[model samples]
Target: MVNNKQKDAPHAQWPEAAQTLIALMHAQGEVARLSEREQLISSLLVSVNAVLWAFNWETRQVLYVSPAYERIFGRSAGLLLADYNQWRDSIYPDDLEYAEQSLAEVLRKGAVEDREYRIIAADGQVRWLSDKCFINRQDEPGQPVIIVGIAEDITDKKHMETELQRLATTDVLTQSSNRRHFFECAHREFAEARRHGSPLAFLLLDIDDFKLINDSYGHPEGDNVLQRIAECGRGSLRRGDLFGRIGGEEFAAVFPGCAPDMAVQVAERLQQEIQRLRFNHDGQAFSITVSQGLTNLTEADESLDSLFARADAAMYEAKRQGKNRIIAA
Candidate 1:
């Protein structure tokens, strides 16, 4: 019903306006999608097993903590949020200094921070946590920097690693330190004694006539004897003493503050205890004796090897002389 000029004029403007409306609709949809995605991510972080946290440098405060805080720390999130010290105080005393150093380094140098430390939970369980954080600087010249991080519970992994290390360093048969671990420990102790001029003693002990026992009573009985001797030695030694099984039917002990005279008494006591140990197999009962060689840290000693050599010679002398006596080198 309209003229051609009127219809053409309206149609010409309509395409531009329609295009604008379509573009606006698309922009709105995109914003909504982003918002929904952000919400989903936030929800996931709160429900995740790991704890999410944010700290403000200016306020020296914890600005945010995800819900997993309660699960990991065995305390209410409200307590932590209300008092920042609540979390700081929960850190194990031994690890507090290291944690502080890590945080200082991150803040001062904008470094990527990663640390592992232990924390005592409210339930009295010790838990290990692995923390990783990154710094976010504000655009303004004097604004507070923010730190964002995640903390993961790593107690099981730490325990497994500790058990593996123990197995590696311990003798499986005697349940004492192996030869390598013993030497490693002795090296450190020797250095310490030399540095501080402290008295230290080393003892080399061997079972007398062990081969005869194995031949007479079978290898199993010999093994039981070794285990029993190790148990007795462990019980008789001072708390600070280091004992290890270095070879078949041979063991070593390091005494960190004991003089040569005192070490002789210790060896004599251990010998008596070994004699007192009674073993019953089937219907027979028997006892065993040990030969010991004792040596004290000397000014001439340069290395653990030198000390061990002297002790070994003395032990062989004990075996040669009556087979069940203490000899000093």
Candidate 2:
């Protein structure tokens, strides 16, 4: 059985699918056709994709739930006996307060608004969601008042957002963080260091003579070298460390709590790790070495551009000094 919260189920006690038809027929009568309008309103409530939470402002009893309520909520609205506060048990704990506040506001002015919240499925799965409500208020005796709302499933949109974030930050080839994301994340680390008066370090690494390997062995062999380097980088860094594929044969590492000297130690370790990488192509075994540049975060100005400039300059110095060496800036 599908739950009310599952986005596909029955929610209406009275089926009113013909009200839209009534609204279209403009009748020239002396008196108002109140029943026709009411029917149209009820059918609309049943057809909407969102949950229609309707209540009598005076009685405080829920008068209606759109047909999709069970589909989106999992629980039966009729079981609550028109007491909408029964939603307290059905709603996700984190969203209950917001829901209650919105309900209060709606009751106060019958204001129309949309809200997003996490709700529990009938089967106990948590899902992200949003709902739009259009409320109608009345303050007379022997007359019906209603609050109409539509609900839509936004879980797919939320998942898409998360996946996009991953793509933006992660390198497609090596599944490591990408260069842009590396810099973006490193800035946050730098800010924290500046706030706490801590040290931050960076290492800019490049494979030694990678073009020579590509020329002699072919691009495939060079790719193997890069992949091997990525694995080594992952193995060398600790948790909370950020390492990225900064370029074709270049990489970067951000160490949040390390001094310039310690950064040099890390750069040297990475260089040694790269030297230990062994690969075989067409039954031929070979090794590769890496040159690295190190830099420390300073209180003078903790900016991404400044740090990158220092690291890049130090990296060029390492490259100039016969490659395979570490230079600090």
Candidate 3:
């Protein structure tokens, strides 16, 4: 309670002790600061959506994993730390080999930044991950080699990309391949067929009296007919055949490895399917028909344009002769 001398006595009697006391106080402050820093780092890791992990490659063990492991994988981090296979088992079966191979690549390359794969979460939901990993340490005399990585959930991004691709490649109303996408694929198929000398048939189809139907039944019904026709084309074609809506009331198909006879049968089946389709408007039922022009890849053909010209001319010929018929070129 009282004294200036009392406070100074210890310092005066043992100067070394006083210095040690001061050093001890500073150390305590440093410890507290370190603890706060650690807590802050922990909090930041927990708040992030990506999982950060460290693995002891020599021992084949997981050294540490962030809290986001549980959130993204829907599995316990404790289980992962206990057994590395927990992570392995979660990888999609088809992707497991590539995942392991790519991770191993990090050893040679020191980093793998372009890795992406799929994993099945604990809730049985499949999620995509863009996992980038690096060698945290090189092999030392006695130190354990460490591999560190960050795994980010990219399911939403993958889905968005897929939807974007579908939109870019698909017709909105007919749900068939769009004209540009169809031509792109057809040209590739044409080159392949030419290279292999394989039979390739192209068929062009046009709905007969389409304007009259649209005027009588309204544009909505016309759209419905187009969708139905696309559905028929999809159902009637072989697995590898390509079909698309190329223009208003006009559709195209590329049949790879299909001979002329088979292509004719397929075109006939599609025609019959369209004929069987019955649409109703204002209590009146009506049926639609299509004229098809079919052409086979000839030795003289150089590009898809030539095939298109022949098929277009043949389709016009069919339309001129009569409606609802198939003509071969």
Candidate whose lDDT is highest:
3
Error of model 3, residue 20, in angstroms: 1.7
Would you list the rank order by lDDT, best first? 3, 1, 2
Cα lDDT of model 3 by residue, 1-329, tens digit: 87999888876878888789999999999999999999999899989999999999888899999999999999999999999999999999999999999999998999999999999999999999999999887556777779999999999999999999999999999989999999999999999999999999999999999999999999999999999999999999999999999999999999999999999999999999889999988899999999999999999999999999999999999999997999999
lDDT value, candidate 2, whole model: 0.78
lDDT of each: 0.90, 0.78, 0.95
Q: lDDT tens string, model 1, 35-145?
A: 999999988987799998988866778888998888899988887777888888999999999987887778777765469999999999999999888788778898778
lDDT of 3: 0.95
| Candidate 2 per-residue C-alpha lDDT over 207-271 given as tens digits, one digit per residue, 9 for 90 to 100 | 88889999988998888788888888898876788999989899999998887776777677777
Name the runs in model 2 displaced over 4 angstroms. Answer: 1-47, 55-63, 78-114, 124-126, 133-148, 231-239, 261-276
RMSD of 2: 14.9
Whole-structure CA lDDT of model 1: 0.90
lDDT of 2 at 122: 85
